[model samples]
Target: MTALRFPALAGLLLVALVGISRPQPVAADTPAPAGFAAFVDDYYAALFAWEPNQATYAGIHDFDEKLADLNAPNITHRADVLKKLHERLKTLRAGKLTADEAIDAETLDHAIRAELLELEVVRDWKRNPVVYLGKPAEGIDMLMKRSFAPPADRLKAVIGRLKAAPQLLGAMKTNVENPPKEFTDLGLIVAKGSVSFFRNDLPAWAKDAAGKDKKLFAEFEAANKPVIEAFEAAAKWIETELLPKSKGKYAIGPDAFVKKLETEEMLDVPLDKLLAIGEANLKRDQETFVATAKKIDPKRTPAEVLATLNEDHPKPEDLVGATRGTIERTRKFLVDKKIVTVPSEVRPTIAETPAFMRTGGFASMDTPGAYETKATEAFYYVTPPETEWEARRKVEHMRQFNKTGMDIITIHEAFPGHYLQFLYAKQYPTKVRKLYTCGTNVEGWAHYAEQMIVEEGYGDGDPKVRLAQLNEALLRDCRYIVGIKLHTEGWTVEQGKKFFVEQGYIEPETAFQEARRGSYNPTYLYYTLGKLQIYKLRDDYKKAKGADFRLQTFHDEFVRQGGLPIKLIRKIMLPGDTGPTL
Candidate 1:
């Protein structure tokens, strides 16, 4: 579990939209070709039942009152289910399906295989304590953050999840044996954060609901204590016991890592070749950044220019407003330039970063699932500097939200990015497509959006804006290289931090934060890696379409495929082509 990773009101409509493409659950006995759609619906229903928190987040709230059963038996049961589903999927020949169903078949098959790998091989739950802690905190947070249901109804769900929370910790005590030191350390951070979440943030949120029903409130108050104490105890256990005996290793090693790339993302490139591609991309971005900085002010050094850009930020008071301010402008640009369809006319609701999630860098999008019913609000979260931070630390943190940086981040997180992507998720061709997504497709699209907008003239030729965009690219570029090195080459987080500072040009404090994030999230390289793939695909797509190539048309089609990997996207767009993704 992580310390970080939230509400709704005013909206009266409860959108009980289920199964993205189809209105009802797929029938079990339905035959193939046409039945492929039913298979997807069945797979999602089963998957969401196993992951109730995800179900809630996805806008299906039937399971909102239950947390996942993380004990060995339940875990094995779910894995066994996936195994059966895997075999069942194989029985239906993709060769027999229609064009669209064939893609869905391949995607659903890949998704099942990927989960089995994590369950059987990667097994982070058995090795990583953070998984145990993160899930509950995220689960409850989902309950509180959205206004899908009434406060009373949501609070009841919270109470139910809180009661179930203790079992999660007990399972952790049994399941997470010897974790990596980093895993233990990060687990403690999140566990402690969860403690704060329950004690302060949770009660404040529950008060209104409690106020409405004193008995229900008392019940919630009664139930909330054990969950808070459970998290606190888990944090203590991690600090005292797990940290001392953490003999667990973090690296998946070369073979497992390669298989992860191939099985999950359908990319079969060698690690060294992947690294070379990442490095080449980084070099180009760094050079462009330096050149852009020089253009901003020829007399100053590149680093000095970067510092100036960092300093050109919103005051702590203005961070959310600054982020909010970017939306209309970005949306207008996308529409005016025809960059992509605005799936819906709606704008994302901008809000402050949740307290627990504030430990990481500022900004994230909490999108309601396309099929989200009750809590339909999609939040664009921006973290402000902590009031307790020293002036220097505050300045460093705020630098990340500098004028141009805000523009670039806004591009990535909102307009023509995640929020936009979320808008289209439901309308995709298949149910499985709406549920399963790879980081390469998800983060890659966001990262690529940052660059694509600037290239499409969002920058208006301001070198500083271009520099800010490049700096963001450089950070992701560093993640690409650092993820590869830390996981494969035994580089320490400290070494990764130095690389971020020297090569990525990120400030030291933020640089360390990014590096530590890599320790836990190694596949983050998908941002830059995915961006590169999208670029290649776009070029190939343009070549194929020739005069038919409209940038907006390309983007509209790309996002419409849901968050499938670029390789799968290539099959749909550049039909029958199996060229390299990069």
Candidate 2:
């Protein structure tokens, strides 16, 4: 997840509504209560100040020079501060607020509670080493990737973070207790990759951004040197010290997991019922997979048909270009088919994945935050096989980027997916919605787009395309089951991996990565969960509109509502209807 910041309600209220192709004025016309607004402003200002990396991502620059204070005292103090804020929020008179104000108030309350849970209950700071090790590069990368400021200005922020990296790493060394071996392994990947990032990749970026400024170079060198050493040392420590004894439990336990869903997604379903829902979806998708494969080539097994599709892939050298070629075509499909409205013609640049992030990431969309104005460029990164890999291994990896799979991925990541959804950030109803988001709402929409486009006939009804779409859906379905089982049912990572291969029918390498992700992100089920929720919402919306319903209108309104939990979204879209989210 990208780090982000929030603004005061009054500051948010001052901005005029940015016109879109079709605007929906969802926020209340009246101003919020002054005391409530002030409380929100002070809370967000404190929040951004405490977590500066998030500030940078929110398009706020004031805290760019600082890193999160990870000292034990500061950590304890922050928790106390949040507790006080929570109390203050509870004291606010919600009934007197405007409609938008009430909604935002709830959103803000949920966010604060979620953070409190992490800091006080989950205590990832003490249990998860990746929390500290992953921040330095990520914090700097946010500053580096977007040219929001002049190179000199951004370099200054970079140098500041570089200097602060040692402290953060020190916190990692001192604070992280007995995390799961999986957690340590994940930390090592980031810590070691960051070593290369600081050593080889970061200097090149600094040199380009710094240009001919010799003094800036010296400052960067001084700040950056210790960061590299610190990472290298931290990596070795994790390898030798932590990994050997890293035997702590990874699961947050069933109750904590359920509470997480309640707070994060407003999902209150029981664990068994939720798992049953996921399993049901998986079974349906698997049946579709088998049927679709028969249409593609009846003689071949479903896996064999997928392997045949894999043979039609781009050479590794052309991977990025091949992906770039899909954007306009896919955008055109959205427009021609009326699948969804493409608000901005500005296309995201297709680029290779950053060296540091190429480990498990295959393709991803990186968009600017809601409040961003200066640096608006979005990136769609596609990872190509490394040069050092054997020809057979490289070929195996390239199969993942086969034409049909790439098209589905592009749909999921770019056109009418994440990139398209983010284009509506300026139109979000309130500041609270802009500041925070629901994962299911975000990932659900993207995953929904993949199936929606195909259902609208993107590939002339080619069964291969349908199979590819099912393949993607099955992966998410597997994530839904694996995530729940891994955490709540005592399933091993190996068991999860096998399920991915046998049930999801995914590549073994990708399955391993997905399983590893489930260990840490136990709620990675959001993709399928969210998608199913959207499908239900759409169906309900269609029934309500009847003859008046238009697909594009439903989509535009959905995107405009911002990334609230689908439950909250349903309340907004289908007033007074208390239907289940499933």
Candidate 3:
């Protein structure tokens, strides 16, 4: 059998005339070699069905009314389904497919392996108590934040998820045991934080919601009240039961970490080698930071110079407006420097970070899914200090969003950073590339943009601005080093924090948070890892293209390849060149 062409009727007729109907038309619907496209389509269908909330966020509304079935049986069922897909993928001949299809094949295969590792190996759902809190919080949040659907329609989806919330969380009492103390504490924080999302944000959003049937409101009240109550109970359980029994161990170990790096990022480098690379970068940046500080003010140390920059921050009332001010200046810098083709002139809308999101970071960019053609508004969110925080604490927090820091933040989150990357993501040539993003690719581009902008003279030789950019880079570089040592070298949380303060030039308070983040997120190193890979890629890309390699063209081409591992990007961009990813 050569192939089954589309127009099902015609293919069926042709198959019948050939006298081979034993396997049934459905199985024979696609022939072996030419069926790659159909095979991919089936994979996407299974993906969306298995991860419906993901689909909803991706703007594939077909699964908008569904939530993932977290019950053990359902998880096993999906895992089995993916296992079969992985086996089937092996039968396809890479030489027979188009280049794009071949790359998609690799992306889908990598994604399958990563998910299986999470389920069968890493298994956060079973070990991490915070899994229970974070999932539902994110699920409800997406429905609330996006206007992709009206409140009434989105409400149904939210209610469906809420109805399932009790059992899913309840199952955790058995499923999660001996989680790390950090996990339990964070679970408590996220759980406590969720109450506000339900009590305040949900009600406020639904207050003027259209099509508010009394019956629907009753349904929502019934679902919301209990789930909110259960959320509190879950937090109490983490504190009471889980905390006493909570272990201090959170490392996934060298074997699992290496597998994750190879599977998720396609990097084969060992942990020791990765740490060495991180240290080298850290040393270089630290030297430059000090040298730059001397230029800013000869009498002050680098930390003192950074503090002075922080002191020049915006007041509480001007936070959002101050962030909005950075947009045009950064964009104009990019254009004038010919750093990259921006692909868009429209700036992302400035917004205060949502209440639920403020717990994590000072600022970030939230863009619609690549496939989302409507309601395409992207937001650059600045997390303002909580109103109830002490005036001194508020002042302390505002220092992070200082005018220079805000400029670098906007460059990282907007300008030629995440927002710009997503704009290209929407235009990526393949569906798999559009949907399955590698963290290194996504974050690395943004992180790389920060340093690249500085090198291109966005700050006009201002030592303070250069110091701010290096500060961000040093933070990532520390994460890169600490992540390996904390997980693979039997280092404690205290050790990680000390490393940050010593190497990252961060304060004790912020260092603790960064170190704790490394405890749960061993892969936070991606910011530095990805940046290094892009830098390497640019060097080789520049070498390959010779005089033809325009910086703007190189950047445009890089994002166009979508969020694949730098190794995969190498094959695409530098074609036929088999090389290490830095």
The most accurate candidate by lDDT is: 2
Candidate 3 deviant stretches above 4 angstroms: 1-34, 93-95, 387-396
Q: Please state the error at residue 482 of candidate 2 in Å.
A: 0.4
lDDT of each: 0.79, 0.81, 0.75
lDDT of 3 by residue, 487-567 (tens): 888888899899888887776666776788888887778888999999999999999999897988888899877778888
Instruction: Please give the ranking of all candidate structures by TM-score, highest first, separated by commas.
Output: 2, 1, 3
RMSD of 3: 7.5
Candidate 1 lDDT tens digits, 1-582: 011121111111224443343223233354433356666666777776777776776667778778878899988888877776676778765337887777778877777877777788888889888777877778888888778778898899999999988998899999998778877877877788789899999999999866768899899889999988898888888888889999877877777777777777778799999999999989998888888888889999899988877888889998888888888888899989889999688787888876666556678887776456556677888888778879988888888988878878888888888888777765676555656677778778889999989998997988888888899899999998998888899988899999999998898988888888887676778888889899999999999989888988899899888778788899999988979898
Worst 10 residues of 3 by lDDT: 7-16
TM-scores for every candidate against the unseen true structure: 0.92, 0.93, 0.91
Residue 58 Cα positional deviation in candidate 3, in Å, after optimal superposition: 0.6
TM-score of 1: 0.92
How far residue 28's Cα lies from its native spot in candidate 1, in Å, is 14
Question: Ranking under lDDT, best-scoring first?
Answer: 2, 1, 3
lDDT accuracy of residue 545 in candidate 3: 95
